[model samples]
Target chain A: MAVEDKLKIELGKQGVFVTTVNEIYNWGRKNSVWPLQFGLACCAIEMIATTMARYDLARFGAEVFRPSPRQADLMIISGTITKKMAPQVVRLYNQMAEPRYVIAMGACAISGGPFKQGYNVLKGIDRYIPVDVHIPGCPPRPEALIHAFMTLQAKIDAQPLTGTERPRHLDAAAMSEFPVPTQGAHDLEPPANRLVWPLPAPVASGENCG
Target chain B: MASSPYFSLAILFLAALGFGLAPLGLAVAWAKLVSPAKPNAIKNAIYECGLESKGDAWVQFRSAYYLYAIIFLIFDVEAVFLVPFAVAFTGLGISACVAMLVFVLLLAEGLAWAWAKGVLTWA
Candidate 1:
């Protein structure tokens, strides 16, 4: 028998069961994680496969895929995030309720995979939104995704419900929003640097406009 | 037991309110105590597939979609009307049966008309 089950049986024999409020709170959050039903690129197919009958993501209580960001607590970055899609991704992340988590689910999402060299591909989604876990693979298998979930669960288990340093979602001092990059003539401009119209003069020949 | 029907209703109302509000209150408190609240300019901005929204969300749609919805509503109401007649069939009179038959025929005719007009065909 599993150690927890054995412990539960022992507690039953003693006519008492003991656990902290934090344990119960973490248990509820960990079990019923609702991921946003969003996909970006090829890695999404693998992510979908994980939720199918054969894989059965529901067994971990995370199969409830919400269409709206407001109802989701997990954002599985399941594919490549291009420059054009970064703002929407960040927006969706911002919209998710407190105690939210982000799982970078593939090599493409983690570090842009083979597309890292592409001008339009963002190096990694972590540049904008805070990621809780990173699963590395060209497109990680369903099993790998499950392993990542286990890792995430372990991370959640370690968090203190009430402490000086709370989780990012609960921390009012932490970043709540990421700047949605604006589309410029040549590239997406970060909010810090808004693009000006009428291209500026190049200092030298063969200099890139951007 | 309370003799007044309103008394039971009042208890039920309180129970209903408790049922809805208790969990919501707990969640709000839990979030306030455990979660952090941080807001910034970029995070609060509207999402438009990562790009700035060029135009308003309102856009013209094909008129045929309205026709399709109207047809669906007509059939949906026809089904709703048939349910009561079906449940009380034995209690209903022969005239009532004939009236229902006429109703079904009228709906069938409407469906046939729509089919002939090619409104049923998805474009």
Candidate 2:
């Protein structure tokens, strides 16, 4: 046997396949989550709920929430981006080191919803930031937020970058348009930045509501 | 029970005060070391979701909306006080209940005044 083949055979006999390591690492990465500490509006409340006992966002591995942008890999934009605050949102995104993913977390962030007409509101988060996944709802239920995070993981692992597969996020129109409520904190950073994001996963299923 | 209220309230208030102080106070303490000497273009610029900012964000907001918000806050603060009274209904059964009712009535009277003045109307 040739050197490469012989090495493969020996390794296989020892139960160590080089190719398998890639799969294992990918699996681990796809499950573990480190979210950037940021929230723009009321949608952030639902984002926090996902991490609480009922939704338990930790099951899929995203409970760890980092306040400093440098450490976080996931950016869940959870609220409306008004004209005044849009620049700050972008600033926070740029501060985060890459291999990063953005989860647009509300109807307002996804399509500007009712705020699109207002001169101050940005039309969509995608207009400024690169969004990896879109979760639709005025403020989506916590379960949906978890679902969207899973969807992001699946897309990230599917090898879409090499042109082997078309990532689902590439299709923008399929994403939901977010509508803004008249009453909400304008230009306020949501209080959900302080959740126990990286918690121990208790169970796999969320029987409690979404 | 008499002392428990004072004790529990002390603990609760102290805990709240501690929570409020810890992060903000800690941040200010360490900020002198971590903070850069001078503000840069990036530092002054506002945050977009992930994109660069184009224009200034410090534009004017309407004064009328601010007035309405102030009025809303007055009622909001009064409502916040009622929650603690409601939760401890067993403790403050007769006297506290009557006192809260009177307080709420006064707050309602203010709301009525605002309503009559068109300050409460959104349209």
Candidate 3:
């Protein structure tokens, strides 16, 4: 077989499209959204609503909700941030791989929303992380949430190029004193707080794992 | 009539300034307290077109990027205003609601213009 044919055969076996870096990024952003499950407050309910059948977030490839920040790209911060939670939020942002984006998903996440005058809550998450999109509302409707995603997609489409610095690959020594907090947490979720709605328990379905 | 909107605006603007500055200040102070080591060799060099770049990766950003960013800001502000109106849809008088609808149309015009200019296109 010719060298080119052999190369083509190898690529076909891998089942990965050979494309430019920009095309790969564009493809990833348009599909395969894995969001971090950072359900902070009331807004988290609505974020989940976007995932449910009514709103059907699956259409946007965002149904795969990952708990670990390291594995997720979209960090949907769906509530207020307290001072105690700020460092942890920063840590999570740092932990996520490169090309990660943040979506501030409520009034509280935007500017403390209704809790603007509150003592402990952060006025906005943008102070800590560069928010790619802000979906404002005491609780935004599912349609509006979808709009925000579309708007973000458009923005991503407009700006195909990443900045000069490869933020993912920082210097090892720089990471040494990074003091990336791995241990203790300042705020604990109040035991009183629970899901406002009762979702069903999962059952093992006899379906093929596609 | 008695109280000045400008006064409240000035106060809010200062508050916004503080909100923007505080985190940046903290990050800088933290970085100083725990100074990270300087990059050496490949780390020091700038990134290129997905290659192990031979030269510095410090390419000056074009002004067009800023122009597009400013356009994005305009839409973002539109979203901010649209949210409140969307939330209070029922309470707002029909006349007020129509006025908001007109305002939204105006925002869509900006989007239309942006789209026409191919500013939204990646290519």
Which 10-residue window in model 2 chain B sums to the lowest lDDT? B34-43
What TM-score does candidate 1 get on C-alpha atoms? 0.61
> What's the TM-score of every candidate structure?
0.61, 0.45, 0.45
Model 1 CAPRI quality: acceptable
Over 4 Å off, model 2: A1-21, A160-210, B1-123
What is the per-residue lDDT of model 2 for residues A1-210, given as tens digits with 9 covering 90 to 100? 123667888999999865544446457668876998788889999988888989998888889998866567688989988767765676676565445678998889887876766645655667555678988899899988988998988866653332334332233333111121221244323211212122333222223111
Candidate 1 — which pairs collide? A170-B35, A170-B36, A171-B36, A172-B37, A177-B43
lDDT of 3 by residue, B14-118 (tens): 999999999999999986664333333322324311123455557787878875886887789888998998898888898998898888888788878888988
- Give me the displacement of residue A39 in model 2, in angstroms: 1.0
Report the C-alpha lDDT of model 3 over A151-210, residue by residue, as the tens digit: 777666545444543332333422311122222232222211122112232111222111
List ranges where model 1 is wrong by over 4 Å. Answer: A1-15, A191-210, B1-123
Give the chain A TM-score for each candidate.
0.82, 0.67, 0.67
Q: How accurate is chain B of model 2, given as a TM-score from 0 to 1?
A: 0.44
